[model samples]
Target: MVRRANPAIQALKEETYIMSAVFDHGEFDHHEQIVFANDHQTGLKAIIGVHNSFLGPAAGGVRMAPYARMEDALTDVLRLSRGMSYKNALAGLPLGGGKTVLIGNPRTDKTPALMAALGRAIERLNGRYLAAEDVGMTLADMEQIATETSHVFGRDPKAGFGGEPSPMTALGVALSIRTCVRRVLGRDDLKGVRIGVQGAGAVGADLARQLGEAGAEVLVADVDPARAQAAASAAGGQVVGVGDILFADVDVLAPCALGAVLNDETIPALRTKIVCGAANNQLAEPRHGLALAQRGILYGPDYVVNAGGIINVAYEVSGTYDAAKVVEHVQRIPRTLEQIFEEAADEGLTPDVIADRMAQRLIGRS
Candidate 1:
């Protein structure tokens, strides 16, 4: 079962990967719904992946990424939406999973008109899916989207909405790292702990500051020098070369940037005792989880540890956006990771596999 992308959308998605115009619906056939949005007037072409809604309304973020093909975008939204389902369920949120993607270069293509068109497309879905800020999308963009539809989250704090979830996401990852460190090395605090953070964007910058506050020596690496410098300034950290983040001899390697950064090429070079972060799909493949374990690295699955953002916005979806409650909930992320660590040790499975099983049990019942 496959649907080829229309010509208009195909042309819109070719800004990232250099490829032909071929497109398909991708491999994840268990999706609850898939919406292809194209508004010629606004030049908005996006795809929303609603992976599951049995637990509650599907909630996730909208990312504007340059993709080579429509199929690449679909594949991403589907996987990420499904990951959100698992992420929310494990975090004890009363929400399911969904996500979106606007195909274009965020640098020069973003506009209020495009954002509103995406919002209208989301409005068509009613409450089946909720939107927040994701990669390449900003809170200001969410505001423009809100002008067209009320089903938006992550607006500016001045507007009295949930605001950006990246800080919360970074906080969650820090807590998860503490959990991993405590259980693995019997440490009580992060003081003097060496942490290498890849990607110093919104979430990474916050995570770096959190690490500094916790007394950890932070090394930040980003492809963008300006972003790397800002992160270092934010956390009083040192900026490492981009190639060093994956191989540096740090106690914990936190990936705060893009997904699939940890692959066969880099896994063998990791010297960290703990692998955790705010990036989704850190493992290039499922087998990479076991690889981390085989090398004696305590692996904290991406979805499990980086769920603070979703937990923050989940409240907004339910109309009870409370800051304190969100923080309290995020604090429980470490306990959740502790349980997974214990279970994985007993069952000889990686934390990623354990987490997936836990989410599947709930998904199956739902």
Candidate 2:
């Protein structure tokens, strides 16, 4: 007999319908559900969002964080899964959306056994949902999970053996940023343009390096002082406090950190003309894109700019991984951004709307 639906999963299904009325195209099959488990000993709680399989399988990352409540984790998984859908669609990948979140701090709660158990739980999905690295996941952790299951990505050669996706992501973001700069600043080059990059993570550091190489004055900030210093030193950029990054006097603000950094609180303080980055779910809500446009900030949709890693992983999952193909896919960001910007301008619609329309077209074609 089939099991009864979990209350959390039922609530998520209801919430998705509510969100669809507002955002649209967030359809999910009945087979999709949020799986959860509580490990009192390891103090690990997780919610896995297995959203769709229309393209192939549902693929996304497993993030571990200290969520205040299970509802927070559930909401994040649903939203992130939806983003993954658009991300894969825009990148022309044959995969749907799914994401998993572990409720606990990664630094203290992440253990080998915990990851192994998570992998086992992933294995229970029977290849319908594939998990990989994300905000709180690392290559080593992925390696440990690989021991429990073979359904994970991130080990693809195209990922440079789990190296930073930042460069490729940066390449995409930089290309779009350069395009935005050209349209706004009337210059095709990024030389002498001041850029403030938030979060000195793998992606952020690589972005800073690329900006510096392009002769853009790069400034960086991160919560981790060591990482901030390292990125700053490597890129010959100045380091600033994490909270001070949004207020920097730069041509662009690259939020390479967590999502929802573009909410009302930070948006009013933003002094940049252009916003582009490798971060996912940059907007707290769909309406926030409109807010950014009203503020005259050229916001590059996070999924559009940060699809490099997914593109790389898709190539791997398809058994035809090629570095050149990956680069070609990454390079498409500028063209996509340009098209979205043009459409948004021509129709006087928000960028998020344009992106969703484009993604919906792809889904319909499929």
Candidate 3:
């Protein structure tokens, strides 16, 4: 007698083949759900990835960029959502990881109607995921999203109960930098330390200002010349060219902009002893963490150090947003980094590797 293939197994195999054909599996970490949203009337094309929901509802900011292809957008959402899970788990937040990527040039393609349509898409998730502000998004955009879905956070302040999280994120990065300085440079302060900040956005500029006020000589750069100048002025620092900031002879290189900046070509050119900033998905690949370690550069894992924004937003969900409480919570970042560093040293591994293990265990994936 001849046996036949199980019908369920055959169907799953076919589905897997179709997904592989459509998605770049390299970045498609075991996500729980992936939603492709299209609205012809508003021209809204978006992808939402939920990596985990074991802790609670998935939460992450909404990012809009002019991605050349939908495949690139899908890869971005997958990696970002996975990062969100690690970030929230390590931060001890009762939220899962997820992200939404809007495919368009925010400056040109975004409209109130488009934002409302995106909100409706989020509403259809029925609280499975929560959205907030991210790159190319602002409090106004989040407010517009909230108009359609009650699942949005990171809006403007309401009697200091809730507000934009960029500043809080900057504060956490600054603290983590200080922690790195203490561990590597054996210093209790940042006086006279030369720190290069790449990207002059809200968090970068604020971080530069804090670093400058702490007496570190700051070098800042942005793709936008005016924004770079503004960040420099605000920090009382100097502005470098975008290409030069990464290779600047500084004590630390803070990538506060986009992801995948620490990949192959850029790692060898780094002159800094430490890399810590507010950017998500900074490691182009997991191996880059080891590369940084091989170069004697102390790297504060991006998700671990840049978790302040999510922590701030989580408070609003609890209806217990307190300024002092938020600061106290953000301050925990350094302790977490210190733990990762200590364990990495003990195990002869990079901090990112240790961090990933710890986060995995926390999320019960281990």
After the best TM-score superposition of candidate 1, give how far the Cα of residue 272 lies from its true spot, in angstroms.
Answer: 1.2
Which residue pairs clash within candidate 1? Answer: none
TM-score: model 1 vs. ground truth: 0.91
lDDT of 3 by residue, 268-305 (tens): 98999999999998999999999999999999999999
What would you estimate as the lDDT of candidate 1?
0.88
Q: Runs in model 1 with CA error above 4 Å?
A: 1-29
Each model's lDDT comes to 0.88, 0.81, 0.93
- List, residue by residue over 25-84, the lDDT tens digit for candidate 2: 332333256677556665557877776666778888888889997557767887887778
What value does the lDDT take at residue 285 in candidate 3? 90
Q: Write the per-residue lDDT of candidate 1 for residues 102-132, one digit (tens) a residue.
A: 9999999998999989989999999899988
lDDT: which is higher, 1 or 3? 3
Please rank every candidate by lDDT, starting with the best: 3, 1, 2
Cα misplacement distance, residue 40 of candidate 3 (Å): 0.1
